[model samples]
Target: MLRKKTLEILTLREGSWAIESAADDLEIAQKAALQFLGKPGVMGVRVLKESVGDIGNPAPGDILFEKLRSTGGADRIAVGEPSSLAPVCEDIEDLFHGGGRTTVNRLFRAYLDKNTVTATEVMHNAREMKRIMDFESMLPSAISKVAQMQSRSEDSPTMGERQNTLFGFADRLNKRAKQAESLDLPSLANVEINEAIHQINKKSNGEAPGYLFRVAASRELINVRNWWGKFAMSVDWAGACKSDPALANLDWFISDALSNASVLQDLLGDQDSLADALISLIEIADGVRSIDTEKAQDATSTEATAAKINGLFKASKLPESKLAVMERVCRQLQGSGALTKDGAEEPKVFREMLLRLIPGTELTGGPEMAEAITHRQSHIINKGGEGGLKAATASVLPALRDPGRKAGYLLSLIESDLGKDLLKDEIEQHLNGLFMTPESVHQIVRTGAPNKKMEKITSIFYRIQKSNLPDSRKAQLTQHLDELLASYVVDGKILDRLDDPNKPLHIRAFMLVSMCQPEMLPDGKASKLAREIIVKHLRRPNFETELVAQVPDEAKKEKILRDFHVQLHRSGFFN
Candidate 1:
């Protein structure tokens, strides 16, 4: 392993140092050097006093780049062969490890980008490596931590205890309903109805009795028992005796399903069974919604208008379509580092099932998710403590197609993992970490629903930009940059500046660096633009800065690597 070297990393305009000549590898070095130095305001190490081309040596511009062998002082470094920049994430991780502040985190990211490297194989491998490390190392720990905190906080609340009681009450209500006449066995009808009346008597509310009465008047059982006039108009039963088709209308199948729904739901319990049974019972409720459910397919202006669009989904009845929709959504979730194939464990099974069932759920993860996730840390207030995020996620299940709503589930998981001990700062910190993924970028932009943390960060950015961004409203610079860097527009230009060369070097550099973030450059254009920037502008001494004490030793050849970055910045390659 190479010793980690402290490098005085140079920018386009920084000081120079010593470097070993490496003309023997000049051909490869030149192209790599050219590529690295093409971008303006290039960030790299300055390892040499003179460039290879300057000394008139064979392959004059190239120099050998390595960590100093015999304690070569900083001055001993000189220009050298072009070098491969470190992987973007690993580099940023290193920067963080080195105690770089968030500002530097932003700056280095905006400038020296891993996207500058062109090899797809290399980038893919690096990204995959990073992804694996993040998932394997970070996810479980994050989840457990959140769960623990939530559990602890849950204990603090009288509300959670109450909610639990509500849950039990809800369960008991269902059990009581099952004992009612509608769902109970016919032989038990007399006994159950009596019991139901007893329970009804206990209800001080006249509403409960009325609801029970409607269920008690089951026409089907009444006809079999010939018990007319007791709970219905005796004439209606007599009308059926004349064999009138209208009188015998068994459409009560629908109404009966609906009227008995509450009791049935209680019998089934909550969760999936209850959800499914309730959905079925909605048909009866639909009848109730209509003035005449028998004429359900009858057209009014509204139904007539809706008919055209209603031809989708339910009409298609294509299970494959459902699966495809689920697949698309799951892929997006997977890409965002949210879910994926697990060798030893399944992805959150409920979410997986929801994706499979709703198919359209993937689409729901936009604004709805954003709103849900951003509902505040207090939303995940525990089962009954308050409005907690988890409760919010459950409540908004029907809105799963809204990214904002989908965001709730994601946020809850994160909240659950991080737990309540994580103050606002901790939540924001984790979110900052989470937002680095390509998936998160897409969710943020498409959904227009920003997470709590992103909202804060975005507010801060616009605030600073308003005050400090140059007053040059010169011909819409960023729009122009987007055009030139379209190839580099990963998921669309996140911060596409660089319109005028006359702009401040740091500003230009900032835009250049933004194009390099993985979230900002998923489209693979970051490297293309970076190459152009490096080829033109990376040799000057005033366009950039040199961070000598920071670039650690493990870099294969420190001087060569640093010089490579500097030249790239000088060449206007980034612009």
Candidate 2:
């Protein structure tokens, strides 16, 4: 390499040096004589004195020059070329030969300190050095040292001192990591991050590592906005589902997995995929709902409604819908920095499920909606711990108020034993607050009852009968039922042949008694009117035949008869 030199021209005046010209070179020094004299275009400008030396690498005397040379000073330095890689290689080798953590630490610092050296260049050099020194096998241990140093630093007496050292190491390593992000660096970064997370989980027993997630997110090791996008783009979801039912969880972690708070935030923010998964589960549950509703619609007596719920989870894809996978997603989200104490925006899919399941606002994230209604109901009824009817009813209220799915959802809620009793006093209070209109009620009924051709019809009779609504609302409900039943009762006579069978007659009668409160008549006029209708029906010779035909089980028949006798006695009919 050639070095640029400068010359200093001076005149000896009264034994003091007087500068004439300080030029870039010896030739320029000669031309600069006249210029320095303030007579560049004038004649008779005489040269005073001249001498030259290296500008930045000046040697004062022979002894100084010898000392500088001995130390391999500027004389040995290369110009317009980067420093040799030999030193970096030597330092790496020294570290491999037990130079300790500092050696590796210094290597990273030196690699990043060069203005000319980028992460790509350092990556190339590191690979070459590894190959030349046969240091591939030692890489794992060196990487392990980085993590070990960090872990040890945590135990140091003074936090500042340990933090300084750790930060110093991290500062350089991260700079290199940013440049060599695509370099495939012996899995050092991966090992370190995994170690940190593993240690945190072990210590905290699976608590999320908020700080670590933030750090990883800031580094872009994971794509926050589209964490799952990359993985989703890589694999065929259908194929994975077929191969393993638990693949959703695997795909979540394996796909451009979380590396930072931003990515985690993005993951939590994105709910479409999670919603789709939940919707899939709901569709399956709705399938079972359809079966139960069909059986209820076809049955002649309530005893048939007691048949066990079965074939709900019969789909082969059922295993893929594990709650653990959803829980894993929640775990990833829970660790996000976005979920600060001030209550940040929640993850989308989980929030959607909550809105559909819980009673509060759109942001509700409680686990009240975690399980399917049947599973939750079964859990509440069969197991004795923690669950109460009040809670179950509160959960169902959101469904009841939903105009789109209220009917089917409400039916599903009442289909189970726990669900049937969910309509308690407090829940009815919530229902009243909903201000459910006749139209919404019509939609619910339509959705609940499917016709012979499987076409859905609006039928609020079941909900009206089952709900524990207050008298005022019940009276309003009766008006709606009267309007509905008017089509069946014209000129004060039953017009539908279907009512003559007495099976549906019981269902209609139950709905009427639930609405009218027959025992509350002041003058006994209402009671007499009710009894007259009942007697007219009972006097029909085929009443016994129709009753037996509807309830073939003799014990169930006895129970029905016994209940009617008690109802009649209470209504002042027997007296």
Candidate 3:
């Protein structure tokens, strides 16, 4: 069987070789490596091709290809020990926490990247620790950078004091590294984590991760330098150890990275516009590799990409990536200006874009995303031209004269995020115009053909009940509707249909009872009044005799009476 091959590009910065990028194709990796080599600060560049090994196995792989280049004549910057503030560490655990770990991350970021290893991995591995100690300029460079930053503060310690403290911390770190090098630590690459923890005499799995961090610290200072690296690595580890109690710590790191602006920018990459950047971030979070670095292809169609995003969201392994993407998108949506190249040329584009983005935003940010969408709508309403909120509200006014159109318009607003807080009052005002007043209710009940009028009124009431309006508002409006319906029943002499002697008595009773059903009248005073009218007629002396008189056969007459009682009970009349 042929083994799979992968290519990695490494760039030398200062004295350390750091992995710049990776690709499955050698040509693409070489091209990217050459580009990095040409950059001003890069001292050297190389591409390494390695054969894939079996999963969970950490043995060395065969190198299929290698290439190297260096700026031989370029002057190298001299390394110097500076009087800088370093994190004070009393023990190996101290080195893995707070400022000490931060300092290590900054110093050996390139080194860790070059080796494709995590800070936790370095701390536990003796060989990696010795490599850091041997990296001549890393510590000196860290000292200079920290000293420069500390010097800017007004209450910084004296240079002599700072230097002595920093050097002491370095010495302690070196001593711990030597101690770890002397121990026989198990290789993390293939060890059953739980079993390893047991063998090490750790009390719980919660201690497993911490123990690993401490071990890595002993071997070498691990660098979790970039937020992206920290977040991505934590996600990977969290997925691997789902049951581990240390998962919470990994979650914290993920949350911290997602909230950082710099980290968001890193994830968004270099896009020409806000729309592109947002789409890029969304794709990344959804686990879609939208950007084609190898061929430098144009962006995939939005429809295709959206379908891919939806599929990935359903089955994605990296759940935290979606959260990070949403945070960036929320910030972008709230930003000023239009999302397209046309600017305010056509405001409908903004609406269209919003419709497309809202589903994903809602999936990720929920209420936060709704608020962001509201904010954007406010911007468009206040500044976007003829196709803005004012125009939309105005359009609804024309439909107000037609109840069916009016109900449809109001329903549309109630169903969308655009009609949220920004338009809450407007929606309420329109709903009131549709159903609240005596004049509106009268028109709704008396304007059209009897059947059409009933249909329109029912439709309006159904929508009002289901609308996003407050419960008190819905109640008040519905009560008014019920009163209107009751008035129409009385004034239109609708119940008089039951007294039509030409129709069969049972048929008249069935029609009136059906009208009392909730679907026809809902739970309100109107339905109650209809039921009262039915009960009044049913209680009349000889009413049952008159109904049974219409059915000749005794058995058939009893069955008819029984069915009528059951219908009455179900329609809430008997109750």
Candidate 4:
């Protein structure tokens, strides 16, 4: 049987080699590598061929063909130990801790990406440290770049001072590198990380769990090239990480990677439509893992993914993952362009998508999702030019026939930037027409049952309170509503129920007391009238005796009287 073969193109930058591309054919891989070798800043290129044993149970195969080439010039620098002012790193842990690891990541991102290596890989591997130290221009380039950036700030150190600080950092790294070489420290490849950590702890006073974790994680990432691969590798380690307090850094690393924009984009993949992208993003934000299917690996079925996302949202343990996912979704939601695949703002489609996003926004506690939706609305309105505002306002006019729907539509418009800027007066006029009109007040107070009337009154008051309407407008509307309620109470003879001879004295008192509650009567003329009526009854001769007369037990009668007095006091009826 013919051996299954694969070929890869590798590029050299400074002293490091990174895999650039891969192909199934040797000629295609070699041509691609040769073409890349001639590009500016590319020091060299190598094409290596490998044999695969089987489809299901593949084994590592020998290199069947290999070729290497380098551009002739100053680019071909001999691998020599470069000198710089040492940094403050005292050991392997110091090199990978704090800002040191960030610096390494920034300096060697390309190499890390190409090799599927992490900063953790370099920190524990002596050979990797040596490889970095051999890059003669790496430290100087990093120093110069940092100095340039820092020099832009008014409070920044002088270039020389900044250079000295960076050089000191470099010197520290060099010192640690030399120590690792002298000690013949084993690479992550030579020994398992847990064993390495155990061995190191025996020799040293301090334990290095965080350091060892990164080393093992890096090994797991070996030959994995894409962002999805990194994300998956990080996720696989998450369960193991939860048991060890020292693996907090590993958890943070995973979170940080998941939170990255590029990583999220890759996770969503190239969906056929924006709607597909949106559903996939929601799934990720909701902490739904991709399902592996027989037809395709790591395939995300939209319906299945959304269902899973909705189910897992409340139960998800990974809140950071959800946050990261929502942030990306928010960005897409607010981004410029039509939301639909056909490049048109279809209202029905937009509404459906927004409906889907609302639950996600609540699930993730992201106000940005709401804000983004408003921004998108503004964009759609602005795209229509001057007629946009007029058209939107006209669209709202149809809903005026239905007060509840009108209120909903108006509130949505008022929350948007364009609506705030251009339609403030219009929105305020509409709100006043809706709530402050004499007909509107009469319609609410006169039509419903006592409870239904109270519900309608309270609903209007609540809408006013929750709106972004000005304080003065809110106060005016509330005062008007209160006045109308007070008039209705008087005109409808609602207080006359308290003096009715047919009802029991306690029943009349109970009804009056219920009206005095904040829920039933807000702080206004209506509430004041209810309180005064209750106080009048409370001050009447033999009122307590009549109030509790039906109670058979002397103790119960006394308790009822005392509780009534307390309730009256709490309701602001001092008398």
lDDT of each: 0.31, 0.34, 0.56, 0.57
Q: After superposition, how far is residue 307 of candidate 1 from its true place, in Å?
A: 6.2
RMSD for each of the candidates? 36.6, 27.0, 20.0, 17.0
Q: Best by lDDT, which number?
A: 4
Candidate 3 lDDT by residue in tens digits, 1-575 = 98676676677778776667778887567545544543446665666655244222223343333333323344432332221234544456665544455445446555554554544445555566556544534443455455455556568675445544555555555555555555555533345544544444453244444554346322322355555555454444444543443443343344444545565665555667666676666666666644434333322333333333344444653354466467568768877756767666435555544544543102234444444554566575674643465455654344235665455555555554555545666767777766775554457555765545655576667767776667897788777887787777777777776557799988888877877766677677666777887887789999888877878899999998998888888887656
lDDT accuracy of residue 252 in candidate 3: 36
Model 4 alpha-carbon miss at residue 25, Å? 58
lDDT of 1 by residue, 1-575 (tens): 97443222222323333232222333333323322232223323123223424332324233333121112365332222111111112222222111211112222221112222111111113332234222211212222222222334434434333333323332333343344434322221344434444554455244344334323433233333211111122122222222222122212211122122232232223434322332322221222212223332554322321231122223332222222222233223322222224422222343444443334212233222223233422222224333454444344443354333343344433333223332334433433333333233343334442233223223322222232123452123222223333422333443333524556454455455444433333222334565456334445563334223233454533663465456445533445
lDDT of 2 by residue, 383-487 (tens): 323354455445544434443234334433333334435443443454344324433324334343312101111233344444444567656654554443333
lDDT of 4: 0.57
Candidate 1 vs 3: which has more lDDT: 3
Tell me the spans in candidate 2 whose CA falls farther than 4 Å from its real position.
1-272, 280-312, 315-404, 407-488, 491-575
Better of 3 and 4 by TM-score: 4
Error of 1 at 139 (Å): 50
Regarding lDDT, does 3 or 4 come out ahead? 4
Q: Sort by lDDT, best first: what order?
A: 4, 3, 2, 1
